[model samples]
Target: MASAQDPATAQHPASQNSNGSSDPRKSLDGVVEKEEERKEEELISPDTSDAQPETRAVTGWKWILICAGLYCAIFLYGLDNTIAADIQSAILETYGDVGQLAWIGTGFPLGSVATILPVGKAYGIFNAKWVHLGSVLVFCVGSAVCGATPNMSALIVGRVIAGVGGAGLYLGMLNLIAINTLEKERPAYMGGTGVIWGAGTILGPVIGGAFADSSATWRWAFYINLVIFGVLLPALFYIPSFNPQPGVSPVIKLKELDWIGTALIAGVYTLFVVVLTLGGVEWAWSDGRTIALFVVCGVILLLFMAQQFFAILTTPERRIFPIHFLKSRTMIILYACTACGSTAMFTVIYYIPLLFQFSRGDNGIESAVRLLPFIIVLSFFIMASGQLLGLFGYYMVFYLVGGAFLLIGASLMFTVRAGTNIGAVYGYEVLIAIGAGLIAQIAYSVGPSKVPPQDMAAAIGYMNVAQIGGLLIALAISGAVFQNIAFHDLNRLLSPLGHSAQEIHGAIAGSQSSLFVNLPSDVRDTAIELIVKSISSIYALVIAAGALCFVTGALLKREKLYDSKPVAAA
Candidate 1:
């Protein structure tokens, strides 16, 4: 037998044949080694040495300050989304175009979902610090525009712009944390961000309501963002200059972006939202316009998916969809769960206040105040969920329990009629809050935990997209359901009360449930009942979404939480 260290024996694992032919085992070994090397090269971060300065570690007060700035940015983003919910009524009152009201709320998320994938890729190619600061500046500009807008169209345009900026802010904040903090410490920082997010959810309504109720105009609601942005601007400087792809030229990197894919996705999302918000409200669902929109949306989405697959096979580096991540059964289930949970949460946030304002006859401020129980419980659990994850090192239980809570809460919300007991309603809100808050931060944890270091950014982006997509789809579907039901019920209830077809059409076109206030007592009571029934129907969807979360949670593969080594900062 040849010695173990013999070159011939090492190179050719299989014994040579009678002649001098190469061993098949040796060829197989070589092929496997080459394949592994290729995979490693593909996963490597862009060359940083030539393009960026030496990374100085962010520590002590400097790290604290950087985190503070990022948290503020997050707070601003969350506040923008929630503020629209409470102040939308005030906006309609001022603008006097009820038909345009949904745009005010949809515009921000539309902008967010449209740009998120592109912004995530942009961070990899540009200086993260500059990219983040530029986003903040854009947000400020949009806020200013919103504050100064003279018409509903301008306000919607400003909101879309602000949302685009917000997409950058959100991705930049998460990327900064991941790169700057030590791996072990990241969960704590992430949890801290979640707390800020929860606080924003609470404060958004409170502040928007306060402004709406005060002598101040609803424009101030947007102006407040500028003030917060000013405070966060200086902190941006303290953030470390960490560029993973320092040597790459911006022009080359720009070319590598899947612009066509991005456009297709944006078109699909925008059209879907338009169809949802306008169908049955501005145009009949069976109308040619609505059918055309749906056809276009479907074709665009299919094109986007095809582009994603093509990019993955031909140019994996440029693909926005992380094909590898999708291959994991666990990751796919987690994304589905995240979408369901998000739909439930956003549905509650947007509609709960409307429930108060319309069903119970509360003003914007009063409706917001009534949501304190939900907000407070949600805020508490957002932090608690993080702490428990740190202590117990498990997430499956949280999802299972949280989903159950959400189901119960959504079912309870269905019972909230015009004269439902306040205590019971408050209790239901608390239950929903706890479930939503607990489930909210887990995806952020689980997604990064599962992927390789190079794929962490993509994983995070995917989770965020899932969340925003959920909100978009939920808002669209629920809005369609609510409008269709309300129109049918309103017509049936009001026609017998001496209201003319023109009057009924005007009221439906107005799209304000609060219009019931102007009706005769008999009509008002009946209208309120119809509105309650219509709105309550939406919670059934929420319940189904919650149940999906629970099923996904139960199906998720168990992984040792916090056991994996942190991926090196890009």
Candidate 2:
């Protein structure tokens, strides 16, 4: 066998002198010399050490196909939301209990908020195409589980799982649009995408109510997603791979994940939701459980803020919260506007069906049909806002107009009473829907349009988190307001009719808003009046939320879109 020195000399033939023979010492010396050269090269060429992957440009029919797939996925997410709203009454009727009704709505948003940051980071590190597909698959599985669940608790758990998947799909879609579209053309593409989301939002109630009304049962509302996913999956396969940080190894990416920050945020929001859902409904607001949860939530939120602040100093690169963005007044205003606007929007979506079912004596299908004006108006405005944005290149004016409409609509809704004019009621709902649609998706573009492409994902993710968080808070607070007012009002009105306190509590807890329907005719009219009053009180909160949205929008600093690159010709 050749000696070690001989092998080194053979590998490095340059070490051989002009002579035909090689020296072992010379070979060893040359090996050291070449290693030193490699070290020098590495030091000088740091960028080549972990070269970034080239961004693959997707244009033409392939891009359109990918956008179409994303639209389907988002449509499924929107359908799930309205489906739950339409089916909650059915679920309450099936279980013959109203205590868990809030959980059904609360769980999905909680899960979504919990996963938003993590999912946003995941897209940056992995192949976005695969990540998006996996999210859709997970969502499909969760939908299946929800359909097959035998009890309310299982259904709530399934909603949470599906929500986790939705968080990923939502971020993935936005990221894809941001990456693929030109800066100047992004608003139009995003708005066009919003049209799909708007259609989903519009059709969700109609389709869900039809499914619930059918022999297929309310469970079919979820089962329908599976069929939709089958069509969407093939389209997803054609999406080009997009990995923003391909140079980063999976292990390094995992290490850099802000686990502590994520855990703190998740814990804080989870506890906050628990307190809101339980307080004044299942338990007294002063109950030990409620108090403890509120206190724990407060403490955890403080810790999360502290951790975010410390992260900026210690490990800014790995921080998920992106505290630097908060320094911009416009970003803060945008977030606040998004949150307040969402609060009003979600409150309307949840409670309007209750108004129809309880006050108007409408079934699920009938209520959805009655809601058509609202859905149609909302969908129209969503598409219209995008076109307006494309032409004007300004958003604050739309926000101001939208907020004014929301405030006017919400104030008008509170005036709805028994025997209120049907025409007037529909008109009010249309106004609110138009206002909501104008502002809802447009707020997402504000941050990304102003920030660099590198910051787009985080900025958009934060906006989503704000929206979902607002929905959760609004749902919790509005539920508490509705339950407490309805319970007390019903108890006062019914107790004089010889119903015991225990009986009043039992009736209200067992039948939900439908309790008014099951009462004797003599008491029914009075109960309906009381129920309408309680729901109207919740509308008062919506008014406040809308006004806050307006104020926040007015305060937002105006900024031109930082990126003005022309779209590539299709």
Candidate 3:
């Protein structure tokens, strides 16, 4: 065995003559020995350190495969949102209640929010390959269950499972590419990923509408996800595995894992979600049970903060949510804007399909098919924005433009009346779709740039949580607002049409398609007109919200794209 030598001693003739301190150059054995040490440590303490990135250059096709996998997963996940809106009429027919139908859409997002943090931490611990594979597998299984679901309860379970896994896949794709790609090259790769994501969205409604129109309906939509998921196998072969640093311990910095803090966060967030889901649907928003749950969530959040403080004092390592993130003006502003965006997206999606089927006089199949325009517009912008960001390095111009588009679209939608032109009304949808596409393009960009690269996953998680949390609040409040306005208007208009308010509401409550199918042609057309007018105000409220978010986002510190050049600490 070669003796150890100080590399410094070898260069000095005097020290060399005295005998090179140990082995003159430790470049070889030190690296080899560390690998040996890690192998031995693997049995005792398992860790998949995401540090010490490899030098292997990813080729063009590998980027394509990864993008393709990410696209399928995003499309598959997002498809549920669109298809469910269209097929709500069919599900209502089977399940027999508006409350029951809402659960299918709500369940998946609940699962996603629940699992997001744990999965983010896991990115540093497990083999990313297995994590990606396992998530996809679970999603496929969930999709299968939802497709063949016999009852409302079973469908909720399936959506929850699929959402949980999908949460993993979405984050995994971003982290995997960030860790793998060189810095300057990352934008183009992300752009490619965006393109694929856009393409997949187009398939959701077209395929879903077609399937639902045929004998397939909602069942075929879920099965199609299974087929898309199966296509991910080819990319798995190329996703890189960690080779590890030669002798570094495989054990990660577990003190970074804050178990108590995690439990507190889970308790607080889960209860909050539970209460919100129940609000306006099962319990009054200000009901005793809701109030108690909200109090419990607050207490839990307080406990979490206390635990973090204790960790800072007691632990031998660094803090988790370091002060930099907390003090960041840019981070806070972005968080707020993203929250508003989520609110706008969730609100419109809930009501627009209702309007289309009831007012536009479309079938469940036709209503879902009509959403293709929004999906098409959204996908086109995502691809274009991603590429533009990669090439020019500044995407805020698009963010502002997109924000303005959404504002205009929402304003137009709000102004609509009983006899609104179908073509003109839908022009609003395309505008918001374009805006949403542009905002999404910049969201993944903004949060990552201002924060430390080491904290990228956590930052991404924060942005998502903020966005979704807003959605939860918006859904409960807005869902109630929508129901009240639509019901009140339908009640007033139905009297003139010689229908009872109860009868009109019964049709509106179920799904858009049912509102038409359940009524006579004259009543159906009349119900359509009234439903459209009432919802116009709702769209206006949402448009105002989106415009505010855009204003705030525009005002946020316009940090340029993150360059690979090492940043020096002030």
Candidate 4:
């Protein structure tokens, strides 16, 4: 373990005296510097230092098939993030509950955030192959439920269930790659996942719109997951199992779970999301129900923190949330960077379509197609960053570059209007896409490299929490922001246009049957201006997120991550 920093130090060798021998003073300084670095590592390192069990890596066609299956599963997870965006009108038409419509988008991330840590822990303790298979099966079942759901409530439940499965699948993919690939090869594989994920996220609305606009119906958006799963079912058998605690009994492993901690944390996040989701849309900010929810969320958060400190439900070694991450400046900065990057990326994915839909009168498919410039550039850069990092070994550069792009791009987007040139809007989005794609998945690769094999799961879990939780929080807040502002401004200006309040509400609610569409040409143009103004205002949040990401990137340690020498995980 003492030699783990050798590769980094070798990358920047200490200076020597003119005689080619190290100067005494410089030697002393080098020793002191090395000592300080060791102290920092110890201060932040996890309590467990046990060596992981060795396993045979899958090979040849088996490896190829397994990788394909894993990539497809991740694509499904990413697709779920924005599939509902283009089909909200269709779902509303069927369910007639506009208030619950947001849940269609929020439910998946909430479930993922609420359970990501526990799922990460489970992967560490259980048989890897079985757990991965179970996760896939769970996701398939959730998709089935969503496809067949009779109402919005059932659909929301299915989204949540799928989210839970998605969390496990996501972590499993990372863990599998960690165990299976060589250090030099890992970044390329991880980057491959990022590429697939970005594609799925960008393409989600396109697929959903096609379904909604066709006789196949919007329900096929979920059923599509099952179709992919069935196609890859055979590959499940090829995923080699590598349990960290192989002989541990099922009963002992069950007892090892931090159930109380899981429940407390879930309650806190669930309440927090609920408050955000319902506060402005369903209830006033001053409503008693909203106030009560905030109070409960605060209390549960305190209990969760206390449980982590006191080890009440599980020992420090088995705690789902890693407490030491709070003390490590590197982990803190990485968490913040991941969060901000995710928030910025997802904000655009969910809202940019609305810009086209409202201002340009583009339908779901057309708006989705319009995003190709952003999507193509983002996907290419995401894959490029991974490959370049694999070769160059400086992860910080991507963050700095990406952050700068996000800040500049988001600032430009903030200035856009309904009548802005279509070409210019496309250019602004590409800038943002570059920033978001670069930083989006970098943490997954870098965070694990900072820790030993035994703590990789926790590190991955910590980053996953940031990645999913950030998007959940962003969506909740941005949705509230967009809804409240749009409703107020539209009602104030359009009520005198000979339109009923319901008609204005219906138009903004994404109802295809809204009578607001039948307004006189000049009045409709005015309404479009108002709609675009509200949506564009959300970029202010993206700008803030991008600025934070840049700050964190500047704070990261300057060092190389890969070398000929092994990383000293044992």
Candidate 5:
């Protein structure tokens, strides 16, 4: 009801003044608004074709030495992932227990998943350089234990311990790379990690097989980690101390860790992994023990979630998991794509060798050699994608194109039969390798780019969970699927041929089994076909993971990552 020119209905100061000249403050406000708009436009626009390289935090001889040390640690982490597979036969010969075989492969990933969040929090609260060195020391100790263990149980315990350290090493390496490089230059360095990681992953089984076949023995597979760590030890001391909480005392920083939350998360993940590992192998799906474990895991997970939100165990500022990340659309989509990509990569890495061993009758060395096409293509493309990202800033394109390739590749793999041409199989491997390489390490670069400088470490840690968690879950699921399907199909068809359950299980174990070696020609041929069918079924999981990558890719914003100035802590 007020008049248009009345004080109650006055116009905005920028609109007009009494003399019809613009107010000085309003002119300044106009300029500021326009500047902000320009920045926003730049953020959404594609990067220039000829962008110059930005200066890094550390350079020259120091960075090179640091990189050598970090890459060596990363290689060891990747090597440990699949090394146990080819060496399983040797372990069985020494220990005589086939039932515990799954633990050898699973223990490392389980340890990583259980402790990664707490390790992430520690990096946020303490000196990153010392934390990194401590992780290296822990990894070395675990390796020494594995090398010296006299029994299978002790070896598994060592693998789990090694996994704990390996998770920290992996996350810490990524964090160091993020903190040391500018946002614009991060992708290239991240790609270097990808190259090393791929080399180690592909070489794992080969190295293990070589050691197992030689007088050096399978124990040296683990002992090799310590040797690498010792060579790189001095370089680590020279690395910069990236202390986020620089003024905090060590005792106070220790108190800031969410100890109860760490225990709860560790308990939840370990129980869940145990259920997955033992579900059909050690116990029936209907077993009360499995159900109880599931229930316990769920309850602990609920408690952990509550702790993050309610701050019952620690302040929200000091909590391990960034619960608020759930609110970010970008983060959510990135997490999904990362998980899908990781699942696809690990599934292929673990199962492909088994397929070759069963279907082509290849030994460990031959199967590892056949994996070369996939690993090489994957490594090359990972490096390419990273370099391209730094130049183009169009990360969405990689995820979409990579996802499509994965789908096509996995579909091709699903059709492979026992007599399929090896050349065609290698071609299919190339397609999948390209897809995985393009997307696998992209998240580490992309994730930190999107977050503020203060949250960069947390973002890297979060993606680590997605990467390692997806691998752990996928391996567990595929192993269970392969074993159950192969066992059921083999028992139904071959039990009438006088094959015992133990013999069927050994066949499921693959060509390494003496029981499989003793089978008649006709029986072996039939067993191979059934095993091939089981392996083909596992590709269905890969296909699902690939589809997820595509769908999530479609959901990400088409904006380029912009550099954020470092924000000082209060």
Candidate 6:
């Protein structure tokens, strides 16, 4: 053994390989001395920490496979969420009015948003592998329950179960890859996930229409989730409990759980939705239930902010929410755009089909099938936007394109008379799809790009929370508008025909075709015209929403998309 700094080693610090052979020391010729050799007769081996993450190039393939698994999970999750919308007709037919039927769609995302903080907090304390597995299992159980349920209440419970599991899985899966996979590799994985998710949206309506058209209508929605979950569970089991960074925990391992903050957010959000839900249907907008709920929601939301401020100041474990995120200009703008874009996109999807049924005289299957073009265009544009982000290094363009397309789509609806050509109707849907594709990919990508790598999961979960929250909020508002237009038109016209206000309201509210067709010939034509008028007006409101998105996009600071660039270390 020779010390390189010593006079003797300086002459020739010749060292054998680990086998004590001197055959050019296997190439580098001991240019790098073994760490173990410095300490003892048996040299200390280099620790894994000293090695490059993606050593072998062959090791990269393993991660690609894991990413495929994650993509499947995202795909199935999107499919399940949207498929219910496709089956809304079946549920409404079975359960009666929109008010009674609304629970089917709201329950899942509600559960997802509610469970985020808890699951996120757990990610630090528990192993992500086990946590993700439990999430998949929970989702499976929910699917089973929904598939088996005979009643709406039972079905809603299943949706909640699925939501809870999905929240954990969706949150955990990305971070599991982002945190574990090599930096240069993440973009492809993320891009792949986006493609899978887009593909799922593509398949949902066609598959949903086919299944729901059969006797199994709603059950098929859950069945698809079950089949994918079946495949995903085993893939997840293959991921080892290896932490990329481990063997250390902060001195304070847990923040005092933000039970109060969590409860307040849930209360405010739910109450807000409730207030909107009652509007134009169960109670007038100014009625006691709706008014009181609005008041309470506003109060609770303020309290949630108050609680978050206090938690950030006092908590040593860096509270469930990071203080940095709240203060980050990039984060706030991205979140706002996500909320707005999501609200507009989902709101349009939810009601447009119903409008088609009423004004275009299309059935549920026809409407669902019609959206295939939208989904196709959405998928194509999402990829195009990804390439644009790669080339331009700016996220703002997606917002711009999406906002512009959405506005275009909404404005085009003004021409949607009852006799508008089928080609014209399809054009509007295509415009929406193009705008949606641009927005959806950009919206999902923004939070991750803006937030710190360490906060990626929390941010993603938060992003999803915003998206869904906006969706529900927009649903309430849009539904209220639809109700008002339908209500006024129903009363104004039908009352003159000698039908009572109550009778007119009751008929349309039930989603019955006879609500229009049962009238006298001229009156029926007028009722159909009213239907055309009310629904078309809602599209104008959606255009306003798109305008708001454009404003936010203008405000967003540009973030360069470095597809292969590594996330900065915290």
Across residues 126-145, which tens digit of lDDT does each residue of candidate 6 receive?
45677777888888898899
Worst 10 residues of 4 by lDDT: 1-10
What is model 3's C-alpha RMSD? 10.3
Candidate ranking under TM-score, highest first, comes to 4, 1, 5, 2, 6, 3
Model 2, range 1-570, lDDT digits (tens) per residue?
Answer: 000000110122233345534342232345457667977997987677577754336767777677778888887776776577677777766765566667777887888888888887777556677888889988888888889988888888898889889877776676666555554566566655556655675677778778877889888998988988887678788876655445557886677678888889889888887787778877898899889888889999898899888883337756778677777767777787777767777777777777777678777888778788887787677667656766776677777888888899999999898678888889999888878877776666566555544455466677778888888888878877887888899888888777765555445432344445567887887777777778778888778877877887787556444333311211
* RMSD (Å) per prediction: 10.9, 12.3, 10.3, 10.1, 11.5, 10.4
Give lDDT: candidate 6, residue 341.
65
Task: In angstroms, give how far residue 206 of model 5 lies from its true place.
Answer: 2.3
Compared to the true structure, candidate 6 yields what TM-score?
0.80
Give the per-residue lDDT of model 5 (tens digit) for 1-570: 000000101112223334544332232235346557877987899478976765765689888889899889888988998887677767777776655666778788888888988887776566678888999988888889898999988998999899999987876776676566654566566656766766787788888877877899989999999888888889888777666555557998789888988898888767876787778777888999989888999999999999878889688777778777787777888888888878887777777777898888777677767778887787788768767877887788888998988999999998988888889989988888888877887777677666554465566677878888888878777777877888889899889988888767766776767767777888878888888888888888888878888888988778664442222222
- Model 6 vs truth, CA RMSD: 10.4
The TM-score that candidate 4 achieves is: 0.84
TM-scores for the candidates: 0.84, 0.83, 0.75, 0.84, 0.83, 0.80
Positional deviation of residue 228's Cα in model 5 after best superposition, in angstroms: 2.0
lDDT of each prediction vs. the true structure?
A: 0.74, 0.72, 0.61, 0.76, 0.76, 0.64
Q: Scored by Cα lDDT, where does model 6 land?
A: 0.64
**lDDT sort, best first:** 4, 5, 1, 2, 6, 3
Residues 1-570 of candidate 1: C-alpha lDDT, one tens digit per residue: 000000100121122344444332233235346657865875785554575653427777787678778888988888887788788777866676655667877888889989998888787666778889989988888899999999888998998899899898887767677666654565566656666766775678778888888888788999988887777678779886755444556886687687887888899989998888888878887999999999999999888888887773336667767766767767787788778777877777778788777667787778888888888888778667766876887678788888999899999988788788888889988888888888876777667677654455577778878888887788778777877787788888888777754455445432353455478777777777777777888998889978988888888656457774443322
Q: Output the better candidate (4/6) by TM-score.
A: 4
Give the per-residue lDDT digits (tens) of candidate 4, residues 123-206.
656766788889999888888899999998899899889988988777667667655665466656765666677777888888
Clashes of 4: 0
Q: Least accurate stretch of 10 residues (summed lDDT) in model 5?
A: 1-10
Displacement of the residue 190 alpha carbon in candidate 1, Å: 3.2
